[model samples]
Target: MTTPGHLYLVPAPLDFGCAVQSPLTDALPDATLRAAAGITHWICENAKSARAYLKRIDAIHPLATTIQAQNIVELPREVHKKGDHHGGFDARPLLAAALQGHDVGLLSEAGMPAVADPGSSVVRAAHDLGLAVKPLVGPVSLLLALAASGLNGQNFAFVGYLPQDATERTDRIRALESIALRTGQTQLFIETPYRNAALLQALVASLQPNARLSVSWGLTLPDGRTRSADVKTWKRTPAGPDNQTPAVFAIGR
Candidate 1:
């Protein structure tokens, strides 16, 4: 008998499961999967959150029998940590899941995997192993921030991170500012939470006084807040006396 396919890459709606947020857990494409039943198994990127998310909807996953009971095959982290992508795959827990005529699920800490997280290794490995990788609509921080930012999302790029060195980072910021001002292309970037205040200060100082700036902080959470205004106004405001909050900052003309 031919070996069964391996896994599914399901996208959890970006901001799912809130009072006003759309829940993706209820919508995960599990029905199509349930059709083939020998023993249903799931291997989640974040074992902890996956359990909680499913439990919220009266769905109980076989955590003990799978990763817990040590019954199913596991993808070691060493393969990715020492592999081609290097530390980029560190965040991705499962690397090379084995096929057992059962289906596995590759997920992310939030939203979809492989978009901005380390789940790419699992997806790539599944392809190499000739496994079926399927995905559904999921919440993504990138698009969420852009949509709420109200910037020119039509033409935008997610420049993942900035340089480490202060001077180099400052130069990169200047370059991004110039691009946003000249081309009207929304420049979006993220930074470590600790450096958010510093980054905000730099943005207020470097970006054109009249340039539009939107800082989407704590999105899709109880304290979710979005601040959009001109750089000049942001500079004058006494908001960041240490505004070390998790946020996505966007700058554009």
Candidate 2:
């Protein structure tokens, strides 16, 4: 019987779609780059983005196969929109290459796969197929924001994207605030890059005066910044994440 190949959870830099992209070496560890460079088969969110990431890696460590020579399979568009964690998506078929004893890399556009991004189904499928799953050391924006935020990092929850409706969004914000304040647990969430400023405003307006809010943006880039303060202080000082950049928001005592 042929031994199944391992699935490497490769993390791309957080600067995806940003105006300025940080060098991969600066954001990813040398070992991760080496591992990524050696993988010739991949299951990725987008084939184009995966090629771009591999090109960046090739500049540092030569790839085992040329970008054009690599076998890349992209997840379905519906999976990207609705997410794959609920078990609706069948990712086992995507692992045929791994089952054939060819190592496969699982990649997302940014940060770690299957964390804030859409690749959990692939990881779950790998486990079910009895293939080794290896996650390389890399930056995760949620944890980076949580660690930078002086909130209750020990007890925190990443609630994903909040509601889009104004009223529902406000209601959800208050509910999370209550949990953060009452249980001393940090509430973390992300917003569409364009809506970041508006969300920050809503968070500042909806949260209680004593509740703390933290916003971290451009995490691994040179212009990266993190600001944390109470709601009342935020209202007075008026600071927030850049509207065009990816950000992580947290609320707690």
Candidate 3:
């Protein structure tokens, strides 16, 4: 019987597409970098970004295979738009390399793969296929934001992105706030860098006056900052995350 290779969940730095990037060594453990360096096959969100990330890794750890020789497969674009967490996407095909006894890396553009990211299907498929799944130590923005928020980290939920439509977004924020207020569960979500300020406005306008709001941006970068305050305080200071950087938003009592 052939031994199947393990699937390594390789996390990329949080600085993807940001104005400033943090050193990988600063955010990722040596073991993770070494493990990622040894994998020659990958199933990634975007092949181009994956290559770019690999190039960065090569600078420090020296990839086992040259960038051109790496067998990199991108997850379908549809999976990027409509998430793969619901099990609708079949990811076993992507794991052919691993089935053949070649270790494979699963990467997202930023943070951990499958957490607030699109690679859950691949990880789920690995488990179903009897492949060992290993998640490496790395920075996960949601957890970082939650830890810094001073909110109820004991019980929190990452609700992904909020609705884009004005009324719907406000309504959604209110619903999330209701749960946070009533149960002390921290509500976490994110917004595209460009829509960040707008979402902050909607969040401020919708959450109860006493509800705590935490906005974390530029995480892991030199300019990284997390601001937490009640809705009233946030309203008093209307400035929020600028439109150029990734941000994580959280609300709770």
Candidate 4:
């Protein structure tokens, strides 16, 4: 029996502009960087971005002697739009390198792959094929936000992105708020960077006056900020400049 190569789930820095926002060494652990540097074969959400990330890491800790472009396979754009499990798409083929005895790395644009990000299908495929899967230590924005939010971390659900439509978004906010209020379960979600202010407004307007809301922005970056308060208190506070930075939003009792 041939031993299969391990599948390493590599996490990327929260911000691609590592040179500007924060040092790459600070965003990811040394072990993760070393693991990433050793894997030449990779399945990533975007080939270009993944290469750029690898290049950055290589600069920090030299990658395999000769990392080539052809070694990285990009996840379909459809996967990014829909998700890895959409229509039960089989991702086994992407792990061909691993099956062939070459250790493979799975990378997402930011944070850990397959956690509130694309690449779950590849992880599932690894399991189905009896390949070993390992996750390296890294920064996860959701958990960072939750920890800083001072909310119920023991019981929480990451609901992913909320609705974009105005009415639907408002309704979704109310429903999530209801759950948080009733069960003390923290409800977590994210919005497009540009839509941060708009969602904050909608959240404040839709949730009960006493319901608590937590907004974390620029996590892991120098200007990172997390603020939590009741709807009424949030409404009284003057809004800051519109944040175009990536952010996490959560609500809990």
* lDDT digits (tens) for residues 53-85 of candidate 1: 444333333332433333233335553244323
- Name the lDDT of candidate 4: 0.87
**Per-residue CA lDDT of candidate 4, range 106-147, in tens?**
999889899888999999999999999999999899999999
User: Least lDDT summed over 10 consecutive residues: which range in candidate 3?
Assistant: 200-209
List where candidate 1 sits over 4 angstroms from the true fold.
Answer: 11-67, 70-98, 238-245
| Cα-based lDDT for every prediction | 0.62, 0.93, 0.93, 0.87
Lowest-lDDT window of 10 residues in candidate 1? 31-40
lDDT of 1: 0.62
Root mean square deviation (Cα) for candidate 3: 0.8
Cα distance off (Å), candidate 3, residue 232: 0.7
**Candidate 3, residues 1-253: lDDT per residue as tens digits?**
7789999999999999997888899999999999999999999988899999999889999999999999999999999999998989999999999999999999999999999999999999999999999999999999999999999989999999988999999889999999999999999999999999899888888888999999999999999999999999999997777999999999998
Extract clashing residue pairs from model 2: none
